[model samples]
Target: MEYASNASDGTQIAYTVVGSGPPLLMVHGSFLTHTIWRTFGYVKALRGSRQLILIDSRGHGRSDKPHTPDAYAMTNIVGDLTAVLDAVGVSAVDYLGYSFGARAGLALTAATPDRVRSLAVGGGSHGAQAGAFDRLFFPGCADVLEQSGMEGFLEAWSSHRMFPIDSGTRAVFSANDAQAMAAYIRASDADSGLPDEVLQHFTQPSLFYVGSEDRIRLGDTRTAAALVPDSELHIIRGFDHATTMAASEEVLAHLERFWDN
Candidate 1:
């Protein structure tokens, strides 16, 4: 069942807890909901071995859909995670975040390292605000989201895909609130990502991975991983940005080992 946690700013964040073991908080990328963990098979694979804490970030899923960019400031996003954890009474958790979620995870760890036992970041980076959405999707993609809505953004997004999206996936994409997504993206773009000095001090075990073909993120992700002591890095062969997550079995193989060690 889903539960609600009020963020510092009074925005309600939605989350769910499942399984029973060491808690693993899973945060999804932008344009996707917490349920992506289930749809993409991560929940099924890890649920038996770990208690899963799945959260819907403020502007997506069952979470409050705030349309103002300021509402999604990185601080607020981090507060949302901490709020959810406090509500659930989980003092600390092994945290896993992908893409946009990965970036948020980095900031969260930097701000409150004591709350995260380990950190796993996928398709993420440790750089300052660099108009990533513009480069990741297209120039002015955030503008496209604001002016033309989710349909327009998805049309552009579909053109860049390496594989066909399943119907269920499409439905999820279709269900997004475009204006809220635009605000989230815009706020994220304004974020100053964690500095290398901050990462060099990470005390927890950390894992960083990206697809071999995810040229956009490979260098940044690798560079960031290098800063952490004893962190593991995996380059999933024959996959790009979107396909990296779709190749769930291959992705999980590396993660299983990481979690075990």
Candidate 2:
């Protein structure tokens, strides 16, 4: 485990550098940390041929958490990512993002196309207009935030039928700082929307994966895949938003092929 500071935004982001080869940065989803990648064997699988860089998004895991909405803006988040890469002396690298992390990756590519060699986005979409199932799943999130704090949010998150956290994962979830978790939730809420022009311009080599059972952003993902000329889309069967990360063997395989190409 190694720590990197992004002083440009006054945010100190923590990241782990594992593996050896071409640089590959991993950004995690909301309400979770880079630890999820370790728990799911993503790091181990890619460690041999890729320099896996795992990051704890602001307000999650070991990264600095800011309470104000301005601190978590999309521009700031992308800047934080760039700062991490700069601190590590990486000029360009492949990026892999899941859900919230995926959205961030897209934002980064749009803002700084030259810095991203390739992109792999999972469990993500192109816009904020969620589907019916998503509305139901996320119904009254503000209330949930007020009552449950971060732990309650994670408990409810784990309870969802889509992804169930195992005992070992559950232990890690329990140990997270509540304030940081809440800040992440707020950051996500503040930076939820994706622009159509940016999506259309994301022409870099890209791989997009989503669970067939994911109703929230299916349409958006389809639209994004079609817009990017060099992008490929893979829809996994028997999976939903949460389980997509755990059972992502095919996703990793797609990345291997994409990077090799």
Candidate 3:
């Protein structure tokens, strides 16, 4: 594990660099750290062929947590990532992000097309309406933070049907700082807009993967994919939003082929 200081914004982001080939950066979803990828053995699986750069976004995992809402802005997040890349001496690299992280990756690609070699966005959508189902599954998420802090928020989140919080993963979740994560979620929800005009011009090679049963953004993912010239969408069967990451072998295979080509 390594720590990089985003001097541009005075934030410290922690990331782990593993593996040994082309530069491949991985970003985890909201409320989870890079450890989710490690726990699932993804780091070891890709380490042989790629240098896995795993990051814990600001306010998540070991990264510095800022309390103010403005601290978690999209520009700040993008700046933090830019600083990490600069600090790591990586001029350009491939990016893989899940959910909130995926959205951040898209923003990064949009901001600096030349810096991203390729992009793979998993289990994410392009806009606010795309996350409408959160009202049904986690109606209290919006209130928990202001009402009782991140711990209260996580308690409500773990009870959701979408998140299968078993003993092991639960422990991982417990280790996370709930207050920081709540700030991140608030920032994400605040800036959940992706304009079609901006995305249509994104010419980088890209892959969009979503679960077949993901009611929230299933249609939006297809729409976003259609706008990107060299992008392809892969829908994983028998998986919902949370399980899609685990059941995405086909998506990973596609990425391997895309990287090789």
How high is each candidate's TM-score? 0.93, 0.87, 0.91
- As a whole number from 0 to 100, the lDDT of residue 54 in candidate 2 is 87
Candidate 2's residue-wise lDDT over 1-261, tens digit each? 566666666788898788899899899987688878877889888899989888988877788877665777778888889988987789999999998888889889988999999999987765653332226346545345557865675567666647676777567666666555545555555555767777777768899988898776566678888888778999988787767898768878887888888
Clashing pairs for model 2 are: none
* Tens-digit lDDT string for candidate 3 (54-111): 8988988888988776788888888888888887889998999988778889889988
lDDT of 2: 0.77
Model 3 poorest ten-residue lDDT run: 128-137
Q: Per-residue error at 111 for model 3, in Å? A: 0.5
The candidate that achieves the highest TM-score relative to the unseen native structure: 1
Task: List candidate 3 segments past 4 Å from native.
Answer: 129-137, 158-164
Distance from true location, Cα of 19 in model 1, Å: 0.2
For model 2, give the 10-residue run with minimal summed lDDT: 128-137
lDDT of 1 by residue, 117-204 (tens): 9999899987876688887777788898999998898787777766566687678888999999899888878877777999999999
lDDT of each: 0.87, 0.77, 0.78
Give the distance in Å from residue 136's predicted Cα in candidate 3 to where it truly belongs. Answer: 6.9
For model 2, the superposed segments whose C-alpha errors exceed 4 Å read: 129-138, 151-170
